[model samples]
Target: MIYFDKVSKVYPPSMVALQDISFTVEPKEFVSLIGQSGGGKTTLLKLLLAEEKPTEGTIFFESVNVNDFPRSKLPELRRRIGVVFQEFRLLSNKTTFENVAFAMEASGRTPEEINRDVPHVLELVDLVEKANHFPHELSGGERQRVAIARAIINQPDVILADEPTGNLDPLNTWEIIRILKKINELGTTIILATHNKSIIDSLGRRVITLEKGKIVRDDKEGRYVL
Candidate 1:
């Protein structure tokens, strides 16, 4: 459902984030991106999300070139993809339910839809009991679960998770991984960019490794060999 064809990104002066990278992620597949910091994993994801324009080649979402999307239509493009970040960017003032409901509201969903979907997604992430609690009241794992709940509440076709477990302990990290696998099993395509070797090794999924802005390896049932 997603393809990057000979894509490259270069910043001002001389910073090359990606160089002639090409790959395709099929529908409902779980793909893991592994590399050291500044290895271009995040840059590749930013290009896919249309957060930054590519300096060369093209990125395609299904059959449409993502860079060809007009500014006014970017929101529509973004709605098809969900994102979970390491920081767990929740609203400090909103309760767990409100946080998830806000995503639906932003998409112009009806109140009835928000009410129905929010609870279901929270349950999927195993956060139903904490729905009324604020972010401060939850543990690190619970807070990340809330973030995941919010990301998937829209039932997005693809989820881009960047270091979603970076802030958690090993136990919490595994918890988040399990939830991500569950989401993928339910038919949502997941592209996970992480540095956790154990998580990637245990997953035994498709792995893409980058080195200095280029793909070094693309393996099915790969390990975290760097």
Candidate 2:
């Protein structure tokens, strides 16, 4: 389980990005983090990634405190979690297959593992035909699928999607959502941070709503009321 205990982040000059936030995410759970922009949605995700330090409180991944990890060990922590972002952050020079392969390579996977897993995941994302296409050669939805493919190539314990469908049309948005749901159903945990009401309402999963850096609502089988 992942636990955020009384976590808070305050920037310089009295800006509070998060305030006394607390929550727990069980294994294989699909949770949505929803709120308006500047409501600490991004900040909270960053803290989980150890990209920023919390001003107070603790974040626990299983038993260890994420904040206590040394810089060298941070990579180990991050390797267990996958992150997908609004902008499909792919290498402009690499093809779809190479883009996903690069992630496994960075983690020191062997040639055999890379050769075996890359095609399998590409097929999972229905990108086998576009495996040789570069980012510039693909559509926005295809690029995002490549991003998602890269994120899941390592089979991380959880996937954190930050406004992943923000740039796609409704058709593509649902496509991405379906892919995420498939991943979750396959036993990977998913923490989706999005503001699309239709997506949230359609999900009917756990919703944790934040407003001005405070959690205003949390419900199972939730809809996007805010």
Candidate 3:
């Protein structure tokens, strides 16, 4: 569903974030990107998300050349992708339910659809009971689950979670991983980027290791070996 072909991303000041990285993620696959800091994993994601352009080569979402996508269609493309960050980017003033609802409203979804889908997604993340709570009123784990709920509310085809468990304790980390596993089981392609060795090792899935803007290894049922 996603392909990066000889893609290189360079920032100003001659900084190369990714160097000719190439990979293909089949539909419904759960892939882990394990790498040290500044290793181009996030850079590759930015390129795929259309937040940044590749300096060389190309990126494709399905059969469409994402690098060449028309500017006007970016919102449509983003609607197909769900992103979760280490820091849950919830609105401070909005309740958990509203936070997820706002995402759908931004995409011009109808009120009927938003009302129907938001509750279902919150339930999926086990946050239905906390829907009325504000960000500060919830625990860190609950907040992250709200973020995940918001990401999946639109039923996006791919979920990009970068360091999702970075801020949680071991127990909460496991909770988040389980939630992600559930989402993957529902057939959403999942791409997880992290430096956490233990979490990656416990997953025992396809692991890709990156170093200094290049991928060094790609394996199935892999362990995190930095």
Candidate 4:
């Protein structure tokens, strides 16, 4: 469903963030991107999202060349993808339910659809009882779960999770990973970029390792070696 072909991203002067990176993610697949900091894992995700332009080669989402798309078309492309961040990027003012509803609202979904889907997604993340709670009232794990619910509310075909569990404890990290796996089982393609070796080692899923701006290994049912 997604392909990166000979893609390279060169920053100003001579800093190369990604060098000739190439990979494909099929539908409903759970793929882990494991690398140390500044290994181009995040840069590759940005290039695919058209947030950063690649200096060479192309990225394809299905048949369309992502690099060739105009900026106006980016929102349309992004709606097909969802993103979760290391810090749970929740609204300080909004409650848990409101936070998730905000995404559907931004998508131009009606109040009726928002009401129906928001609760269901909150339930998926086991946050329905705390739907009225503010981000400050929640634990780090709860806040992150709310973030995940918000990301999946629109039913994006692919989820780009960048260090989603970085701020959590071990049990919470496992909780987040379990939820991600559940989401994958429900048929969404998952591309997880993480720094946690224990999480990666336990996954037993396809892992693509990046090092020094290049792919060093690609394995099926892989363990954490770095």
* Best-matching candidate per TM-score: 2
Using lDDT as the measure, the top candidate is 2
CA deviation > 4 Å runs, candidate 4: none
* TM-scores for the candidates: 0.97, 0.98, 0.97, 0.97
Cα displacement (Å) at residue 36, model 4: 0.9
lDDT of 3 by residue, 136-216 (tens): 999989999999998898889999998998889988999999999999999999999998898888898999999999989
Candidate 1 wrong stretches, greater than 4 Å: none
Candidate 3, TM-score vs. the true structure?
0.97
> How big is the RMSD of model 1?
1.0
lDDT of 4 by residue, 1-226 (tens): 9999999999999999999998899999999998899999899889888999999999999889997889888888888888888988899999999999988988899999999899999989999999999999999999999999988999999999999998999999999999999999999999999999888888899999999899999999988877
Candidate with better lDDT, 1 vs 2:
2
Off-target runs (Cα >4 Å) in candidate 3 are none
When sorted by lDDT, best at the front, the candidate numbers are: 2, 1, 4, 3
Tens-digit lDDT string for candidate 2 (1-226): 8999999999998999999999999999999999999999999999999999999999998888999999999988888899999999999999999999998998989999999999999999899999999999999999999999999999999999999999999999999999999999999999999989999999999999999999999999899988
- Model 4 Cα shift for residue 166 (angstroms): 0.9
**Residue pairs clashing, model 1:** none
Better of 1 and 2 by TM-score: 2
